[model samples]
Target: MEKILTGTVVLDLTRFFSGPQATLFLAGLGAEVIKIDDPATGDPTTFSPPFAGPEGVSFHRKTQADMGIAYLKRARGKKSVGLNLKAPEGRAAFMKLVRSADVVIDNFSAGVADRLGIGYETLREANPGIVHCSLTGYGSTGPERNLKAYDLMVQAAVGMMSVTGQPDAPPAKAGSPLSDAIAGTFAATGILAALLHRNRTGEGQSVDVSMADCLFALMFDEPFDCYRSLGLPLRQGNRIMRFSPFNAYRTRDGWVVAGAATQDDWNALLRAMGREDLAENPQINSLSWRLANNATVDSLMSSWTEPLESAEVLRRLNEVKVPCSPVREIGEVMEWAQLKDRDMMMPLWNPLAQATVEAKGPGFPIKFSASKAAYDTPAPLPGQHSREVLMNLGGFSAHDVDAMARRGIISAP
Candidate 1:
């Protein structure tokens, strides 16, 4: 099937999670994503721990020359090009590629792109309709723009940590890199919007994505409104302020999550629990009343769930149409048949391991009937496609390529 973005070219200059993830989505949609990395060390995540192959850390680092899982997971379906943008020749070569490309993306500190001369203005000069997207810790013009931030830092800075975990415990970070991942997805949407604009008016613009801003959006409406209106952060772990009976309760065998967002759902839950009488209770009838007696409501729900196994609890709740599910581990999610049916768990060959690896993909997240969204290739090693890219895209001769490699302007692996 013809992919959605077959004709588009994306110059990916992102190192870590956010930018790379954005480009990964582009690549999955069939954009030709050329990942530019530093020739000396490449993406630092190449050396990140927890090796998947049999030989372990040393082999992952020195021998197999395979990407760490961190890089591999996010960087799949992109070509690799190593270039030293600080060098004059490298910058000129990058500009040449920019001219032929449709989009350029990066996740660097604010001002870093301009300092490196790869800012939107400079690239726009090379390709008038080029879409330039940048993902930063804070926005370009903010007071904290110049300050450094990673996923954890942004989470803390954005008050995410304050509202996470048990109220008694110290502030906690989300288990995943939520800020980076969401920002990357947002950056991709911005780039797509810019591409649409280019299609309409032949004008490209810069996409400025702030991780802090993205995290705030994920904070959801209730907490956001609470903070704004009540002037305090709510840290009731897993207990949503606006909803009743919305929590993960411990069942006999495991945990199950159940939520009653509407009066109907609450009545259904009560019906499932054989406690319909409680539905009309004076102190816990409406959402406001239930929230006011949250402790009692939770205890009441726990009383029903605590004696039953999670599967049984989930089955009874689901039978009554009360939204519920048993808590699943990562392993279970990876092996889920439903996700497999959706093609979310993709199998790709691991050349180094001489085996097929089941790598999870977003499965086009958005389904389109005419154009298929698919992962075309695995992530490349640093500079793996440098020679071919230079020859085809940059219009460099064999001699020019060799000279650039010798001068440390680019790497050819």
Candidate 2:
């Protein structure tokens, strides 16, 4: 069966999580993603690590070998090529690849690509049908476009930090790189849309994805309504800003998040807790009333949950058709049967670590009857496929590849 993106070739000039992650998704859909990196440092993510390899040996290993687990998780199904984009010869070689590619992805600062002579306008002249995706911290025209940013910085700047954590505590960033990942997802979606449009019109366009913009957009309905109608929104912690009984609560064993956002669910929850009287009580009956008397409802629920373990509480809630989940730590999530059954988790063998590691794979969102997506390979070491990509994709002779390496324009693992 033909894969979704089988014949597509993507020249990936993206380095960090956002760009690389977008390419990774394309690769999973069966595009041939050729990731180009600077010969000197490669992706910065290669150096950011809490190494998971051998006890002491892991530290001494090169950045390529010590790429943090997150990179490994995101970089599956892609090939790496090292090149110095600053060098004219290397830039020419990149353009050669771009000329033949269906798409090009990059996350350079606003005008860096244009300055480097490989911007969308330049590449489109070579391949008019090429889909160009430019990802940035802000955007091409924004005042902050040139400012360097990572996930954490964007999270703080985009009001995600303002809404996270407890109300009494300092604003906290999300545990994951939510901004970067979301931006990557948006970029990928834009690329896919551009490809669809190109199929009909035979014209490709530039796609601009902004990390800060995506982060702000992620809040969707709530933030816009709050700003337009109510003015500034205050931090609500785990509690729902608009609905009551939709927050994490303490149970006997651990934490459990339960939501009774609907009146029927609230009635069922109260019935399950043997407090039907409270369920029908006028003070706590309506959604508005529940919000107004949240303290009383929370207190009563907390008292009822105090004697029950998190798992038991969750199970009872589930039985009553209430939205509830026991708070699962990473280890517990790794062992979860539901995740395993749905293939949301994948196990890969790490040759360097000399052990098997389980990591979360792409969520089960796009299901196909014929061409299903999957993890075909693990992340490559820095410059691991440098020679292969150059020789195979660029059609470079072995002697030419060696000469380029000698000139410091390319590197090999």
lDDT of each: 0.83, 0.80
Off by over 4 Å in 1: 56-66, 223-233, 351-354, 357-363
Model 1, 1-413: lDDT tens digits are 89989999999999878898898889878899999988887878755754444343333444464346666677678888999998889999999999899999988889999999989889988888999998999988867788888999999998888889876779899999999899989999899999999999999999899999998877865556455575434687887777888888999998999999998998899899999898668667788878877888999999999999888898899899998877899998887888888888765444466655434445556668888787767656678899999889999999999999998889996
How many angstroms is residue 309 displaced in model 2 relative to the true structure, after the best TM-score fit? Answer: 1.7
Model 2 C-alpha RMSD to native: 2.7
Q: In candidate 1, list every pair of residues with a backbone clash.
A: none
Candidate 2 local lDDT, 282-361, one digit each (tens): 77788887776667768878988889988789888888999888889988998889877778777544545655543345
Best by lDDT: 1
lDDT score, candidate 2, position 149: 94
Task: Please identify model 2 stretches exceeding 4 Å from their true place.
Answer: 54-67, 224-233, 349-365
